[model samples]
Target: MDTTPQAYRPETAILDLGDAFYDPVTPANFPETHLRFRNDRAAAEVGLETLGGGEWIEHFGRFEPMPGSLVEPLALRYHGHQFRNYNPEIGDGRGFLFAQLRDTGDRLMDLATKGSGTTPWSRFGDGRLTLKGGMREVLATEMLEALGVPTSRSFSLIETGEQLERNDEPSPTRAAVLVRLSHSHIRIGTFQRLAYDRDADNMARLVGYVLRNLYAEEPGDDAAAQLLDRVVGRTATLAASYMAAGFVHGVLNTDNINVTGESFDYGPWRWAPTWDPAFTAAYFDHAGLYAFGRQPEAIHWNAMQLAVALRTVSEAQPLIDILETFPERYQRAVSEAILWRVGVVPLDSTRDRALVQAIEQGMTQSGIGIDRFFFDAFGGTVPADDAFAAARAALVGYTARKPRDHAYWSGAPCSMLIDEVEAIWSAIDQRNDWAPFHAKIAAIRHMGEALAD
Candidate 1:
């Protein structure tokens, strides 16, 4: 009987924080509106599954207001270092926070956008996203989520009828816009901006906003330190998960690193084809700064930068002390992550550490396919080597978590290798055949269900 649109209770929490945090902006006018993808599952999480096609496009594509969501989108303000180069001017050039609402779990979720339109931050660049880029992100986020990495969900993708030029990929490419459902859009750069301005008051206010809205907790006297500690630990866990999933987030810039430790802005991301440490994702990253093996260090480096930004609100020594704990925490998180990928229960600290080392050595020396290696070695089995036997010895006292009878465990593992991704895109580009795309999504979700821990 409760058929009201506001039944889900959308809240403009970020707006309440004031306009200093962001700039009010308008969405772009596209020539055509075609709904390329709609995440009904994510919609259901925020109680919007009842929207029909026209309604979906109206809200997400045409930028029409939801019943009780934000009226004007907010282009967020923040500055970040790009490849360690401090760029004090970069913010959400094309994207903005569209709305804020609580999910089924009562956690505040952000409905945000990428390539929606230009903002005051858009300098010397057209505010648009390539359709290929949008599709890539949708696939990337879906696969990452299925692999159990904490990532933002690509909520909806609409192919705006326009052609765009780009340095990468072919020119005159189709353009699109994306809406993401995420925990928080606040990045390390958000604090970096305040620190750069020496705006300690706003820095403190930002910290308070993070604690209350993003974290759903009350702020304290040591809020910055507490937040930094939580962020560091979660970033460690996120780094370990990326390693376990064989993922290489190409751009590990401070702006891309969310304070919530939830990964977003999937651009130029790739799967490690093999176990090589120097495997780079983005084609432009010829120097391999953010490579597969070096991702942990890059993540740690970003976390430290977050710490540096927090220094404006906290003592330098105290923050450095918190940063020092990263190495030990990362070691523990990686051990747990590797064990989870192997689907084995932890026997003890020592045995688990040894098992992790064995797995790493096997990956390095075996030359097995990165995704295939995990699939074959699930449940502490396979690779048929002395090292793996020793790894199994570490697991002798415990049983596996995954059931053997699961249908997904029988055949090949769910994978998003480049070739498969290319094929999926090629279908869309040539014939507009979305069957492969839909099928891949279903398969990845099924694999996730099978591997649920």
Candidate 2:
């Protein structure tokens, strides 16, 4: 395998793969693993080709390089706050950034394989991922992107015919390797290491590198502070988007949060089918700190911790300014997404609030499929008046405090038609009438185009 550079950067901008990210030399071993999901299109987008054939079992999960490929082993270092407390001992653990490519669009992206055998960071544990865990990540990330959530996508999952031991699930479970594409894998822990080492020079160097690589247009002495602010703003925006979609990231660990504001590491994640603020998806979330509703707050708090790590070099006020924008930015993004889902055009604040409140009430009464209801309304294929009686009956049990047949929209005529439509489509969508769902998405896309002009 060739060790070469696809592109060159200023020496200062090169990522430093310290011992923290590297593992001691060990032969990569994987067995009996099969490719589960191969994202060839996404891989091709970044100038990568699949490396499997009839002898795939011989190469996959092994550290062998593909033809015309460069292998640059990287071990990233960063610190994180796990479960709300500072933890200095966290890093890549087992995985490393293997190579990066500049796609046809001239955008730099990484081709990273998790469970590609262990390195110095393995720390006495098998440096591999469970087949089940990798499968869960593949599903979660794919579904999230389809739903418009900004997430890292899995490119490939290869179940190594190797048996692994884990406490959480059945022992001797299968092991697998996963490849994911992302803007950057830098995290809050990345900075925490410098802060902990009190290496102000390396800290500044890392910040400058991040600015040039991650935010190239914004580079300089003042760039570090500006970079932190931008990260805060983008992080806030992402958090709000997560809330709007009713998705819960069970683990808000600092290591799991990407500095680029992309959601990574899908462990124990869930999407709420209804607007239950307290709904939790993580099985181990005994405290419920990161429940669906508290995601924004958790993000803000995580940013605060990251800000603390950055404070060694940056000013406190700018970080505070960025944190302050989180709530407002989140509100705007979430409101727009909600409005679009409900089929309302050219949204106004008053109308949005009215519709949101109405939908919340309706959800309680109708037992409607949450995502389907709004999608169906936009299609304009609502049930006839006569069918509403049956739809109404379907929703009655969902009402916790009020009668399901309370007819909440009896007086609110502006929303009555959409509500009724929601009831009818709720029933149809359950039958997997995806054609209607597809049509609704197309109609919304058309509306978006008209507004853009």
Candidate 3:
């Protein structure tokens, strides 16, 4: 084993917030370790590229503390309102924050695990992740990141030799563990937990910690309101990003929502097959509470819950004032995100909004696939078909972001529709073929790079 510490800038910032915020836990023992996936890009971010596959599995899968990193895995404590009902029992049941390191951008990033082990928060169920579940999250995160959503990157996945029973899918399936890299692991539920304990001083301390660490530019005197405002903006953009990408998060519980506004914790997530607003990802979401169209509402409601939690330390009216701006901010963000998706830069907000509305109407009336529409309509151009006539008219004055001579423009649009995701996984499950999965990831990354340029 390489005992030398790499260039990773490890920090115990979250741990410094005190033991009340988390509980140290032990990871479960798996009989075997087979590294399944490793995100090289994410590794480079933290300067961990020198660590080979064996070391990656040892640190991530075996739960061996990274050299010069946190001494013990911390299962973060938090409480969330599940589907709008307050639930004080929820926390990091199956996952824990393994380490914190700074990216090249000097931003704090967390390496959190899933299906690694059981913690005190594990309530009545085994703290294990199904291989299929890990596969789905890897796919979901890659696709979302490619689409430019502020989301967590799936870092490492390793098969843990275990067969676990599940109620949702095939029983006694293979098990695995996953690690995700994200901006922060702190959730709105973290504040709720503090509020539930009525720890006003701790609540105030947390607010200061977040402001100093996450939003270091902001003034500390009114940190609570400022944090809420920034969170609202980021959350609004998140909702709009989902709408533009045609994604339904399936579950938008406060615990699943990160305070830093990066989307993570994929469960039953799906892309809309079409432009239907009521499309849902989870099978049990009978009411479509977190449906494609209702995601903005769900996220805004979660922000409100954060505001409620902040009441333990700050004045309520200031927070409420920020909450009231969610609708306008979301509307603006949706228009901006839509324009970004179509590879067009905004010249006029009014014209862009009209174009967005026209595109939405065109998709709804023409029954075109959402991703296909954006793929075809890149560079502010519209299909010549009658179905897109309205959209074509709306884009008459708009300009493309740049020249559209990329080779990707000539290829079929990359999509993560349910059928495609399943096919990718099926190839691996049936014949141990990982080519399709890797090919899909490459294509997605290509699309992301092209968009970025």
Best by lDDT: 3
User: What overall lDDT goes with each candidate model?
Assistant: 0.87, 0.62, 0.89
Candidate 3 residue runs with Cα over 4 Å from true position: 1-6
Cα deviation at 66, candidate 3, in Å, is 1.3
Worst 10 residues of 2 by lDDT: 408-417
TM-score of 2: 0.75
165-187 per-residue lDDT for model 2 (tens digits): 89887677767788787777888
* RMSD to truth, every model: 2.2, 10.5, 2.9
Residue-level lDDT tens digits of model 3 in 1-453 = 654434688887887799989999999999999888899888988988788877888898898898777999999999999888899998999999999998877898899999987999999869999988898999899889988799999999899989998988777788999999999988999999998999998888888888778777544677789889989999999999999989999999999898888999998999998899889999988999999989999999999999999988889899999999999999899999999888888867778788899888888888888888889888888777787787888887677887678788879888999999889878977887889988988998888877774
Task: Write one digit per residue (lDDT tens) for candidate 1, span 242-304.
Answer: 998999999999999998889999999999888899999988888899999999999999999
Cα error, candidate 2, residue 281 (Å): 1.8
Better lDDT candidate (1, 2): 1
Residue pairs clashing in model 3 are none
| Candidate 1 lDDT | 0.87
Which wins on TM-score, candidate 2 or candidate 3? 3
Backbone clash total for model 3 is: 0
